[model samples]
Target chain A: MTTLSLGAARAGVELRSFWRERDAVVFTFALPAVLLTLLGSLFSGVYEGSTVTSAQYLVPSMIAAGVASTTFVNLGIGIATDRDNGTLKRLRGLPMPPLAYLMGKVLLVLAVTFAEVLLLLAIGMVLFDLPLPASAARWLTLGWVFALGVVACSLMGVAASALPRSARSAAAVLNLPYVVLGFISGIYYTPIGALPDWVIQLGSVFPLKWMAQGFRSAFLPDTVLPQEVVPSWEHGRTALVLAAWCIGGLVLCLMTFGRRSRQTS
Target chain B: MTDHAVRVRGLRKSYRDTVAVDGLDLDIAVGEVRALLGPNGAGKTTTVEILEGHRSRDGGSVSVLGVDPARGGSSWRREIGIVLQATDDAGELTVAEMIRHVARYFPRPRGLDETLSLVGLESKRDSRIRRLSGGQRRRLDVALGIVGRPRLLFLDEPTTGFDPEARRQFWSTVRALDTTVLLTTHYLDEAEALADQVTVIAGGRVVAEGAPDTLGSRDVATVSWRDGREQTDDPAAVVARLTAAYGGPVPGLSVTRPSLEDVYLDLIGVPR
Candidate 1:
């Protein structure tokens, strides 16, 4: 009970602190929708060989990009700064469970990721004529995929946060790698077959590609599946891959945060 | 149950090969204001962190509020408040918001308004934390530290950067808390003014521990004249000899006890 209440309060504080910065608010919510329109319109709104609109592909891909953009950067840079600033040390000394602090960051990013996804989803479906999830079951799949993706990305963010020793370097370390993840993971358009097998392996190993594929499986029409590298909506494989990333990312987050806190204290 | 709020025996901590706290022992009775006095890099923070359970010690038997901090759980933590040695991290929340949020973590907390008034931040309650001045931020930190209504409070270098007036105000605030305060400070005056007892630590070991007024020849005056200074066992004897030599009161003679700073400097072996 205490953990839950503390988490709620932490989340409240995190959100208030987060939204106070106008740039962070715009970057997390507005940028994804704007990117979807620009990229979708630029690509002529059609997949290379399919009748499906390119917006449909970007709807899922850019959402993953958006999650990476905000949650990863937010968790990575925000937390390292917090650690450097002694915020984590102060919170660790509190009576609350240590996980409450972690939960607060995770919950804040998850909330923002949801809002980003919804704003993009609404734009994709309404303005771009991106198809809606066909059935209640499809919507349920979208729900789980969204939940898992945000969590996995946020966890990865927390884990990666420890990479940069100081707050000043965290943004560079965090955002630079994200561009690579997006490139290979088709967060932007790529001819999957033209790419080397190592690229496929690399993208599959991280959460970005799998999370994007999972979202596609839930939201994209069946006809667009061939355009995806896997050539079919491998829903089971998508779940397996995303679940692995989610669990693995969570473990990594716990270990990295534990180690960093010990060192700082 | 122990009558002491904190008890330690032979506490030890090392970072890799550097021993930070070497076999240090301390005891603080319940409701006592005990100050850990030492120069910087004298393991003051390391020792306090060990007690606060933020860092693990290599070897020691320690108890805080009757529970070993190393093994202490959430309920044990609830009984103690901690004011760290760093700046506040509220970042953007208003003064009241940060306090309210921190208060939710404790099982029993002081009222929000009451805590604000206690720290004299009621006037700045609506202001963003980033806009607060250094002293105001420090006061907010103390406010958050005590809002949980802790029975024992650990204040680590609480007034390190305050101006004279601010420091005095902070001293009074700390005195008014009415809780067992175990504070660490390098300022001898802070220890002299706020602590009932002061323990001087050097090289990670206690050199002396006693009531502040009686701590180290504090009552012995060092007689000084135009030519020399003498730390005498008997200042009156020195004074009488000087009076006889001059056939009256010694010219430019002044008798003064070593200030706490002088004693502290002597304790830490920083040549005076």
Candidate 2:
């Protein structure tokens, strides 16, 4: 078989193992959807002078968070666990190419992230009356934002996997940043404008904030524009920041991934 | 294509100020099962890792399957298999699934059923890897190593934690394979059982190299007769002289040579 097909087969294996774990499947797929339901119900009123309710505004932001969970958090802990378990060493001894292993990981992230988004979107539409993109342009924006967000987060996760000393510490290392970024990036809070200026500035430095903002522009109406941190959606800046992170993240991954000297045993 | 599956000259490796392997030389002919017998910290693992391409030598000319291991790539990797000392990977996958997944990496892998049976894991074929006992896990390690049908296999302390029965079974499995094997072991009996040639190493160098029965000065035999016992290089002559003296079948007569363990300890500088 060709390398691509072999990589696909590896993806199948990875997916099978992932599902069989039970705990990981529930944690990765269910967390964001559960959070969306509770948060959307608790914050019910529409924003001032706009038809978009707090829950409607939250749907898009939650979608962004779901993407991060499935890609960044998933790959981070997964790779670290693989390293600790001697999977990396065993694969290094085989005839398999490094690219094939990478293909398998990337494909796995893409698949789980796709499923995560669908589940979140389904909950948003069913529980909070969230609407789908109304036009091809809006759909295009969603497409590019989802694509860029998944790439940047996945790369960062791969790079961060090396930071933890072992698999036992991977979740603590990766989740600290993930949870902190969600709150500051306005996934939990609506109308990011309401947060302190310093908090807004801090959130602006990360990709999650830009991803949430991009998703808001696609799903929310212009009437809610006055409540945004910026007067406009600033789609140009959103694309630029997320795109830049993609490049930077890829560089970091290439530098740190698989660079550690493995034990000789 | 080379007559020797592995060849090394002046192999050297050091960690900081401590030297691991110092000017070691080795050669293994195709289809030869050579046992590298050594104590801990004697550079046996270092030498094997360098040859496996898992490590780099400080200075040496080393070749396995006619390629410098430091530069060995996927094509070179295809011709060799490695069973590491201990590992706990692929625990989530069933035995059959993990083996099948690994087999896809090679051009001509053994059939899954045949591979499982070869390692005596047929009963655990559908069981999760994490559920297997320690010995069963080691057998799985061996199964994965040979599934690719590699021409040369490197087994590093392959039976470190096995029971006697399991070790014997493992030796039989290794013997069944028609491939060149470089086995690093501490068990003299295991070496005697499986190796065609035994190389005893100490201080990162070969102290003795020969067949297991003749590795050290095994030519000296202890010839016992009814009168007494004598250590002699010419056991046949001594026995004939004793028989003539007795003028009949000798009583309490037996001839014995130094055991491999005795010779191994002497080579490694350990007092009996």
Candidates in order have lDDT scores of 0.82, 0.90
- Model 1 stretches astray by more than 4 angstroms: A45-51, A190-201, B224-247
- Clashing residue pairs, candidate 1? none
User: Deviation in angstroms for B168 in model 1?
Assistant: 2.4
Highest DockQ against the true fold, candidate: 1
The digit string of per-residue lDDT tens for model 2 on A143-198 reads 99999999999999988888888877887888889989999998998878898899
User: How many clashing pairs in candidate 1?
Assistant: 0
For candidate 1, what is the DockQ-based docking class?
medium
| TM-score leader | 2
- What tens-digit string does per-residue lDDT give for candidate 2 at B1-272? 47999999999999999998889989999999999999999999889988999888899899899999989989999899999878898788999999999999899999999999899999999999999999999999999999999999999899998999999999989999989999999899999999999998899898899999888978789998667899999998888988888887779999999999999999999986
Name the TM-score of chain A in model 1: 0.88
Interface RMSD of 2: 1.7
List the candidates' TM-scores in order: 0.90, 0.92
TM-score of chain A of each: 0.88, 0.96
Candidate 1 TM-score over all chains jointly:
0.90
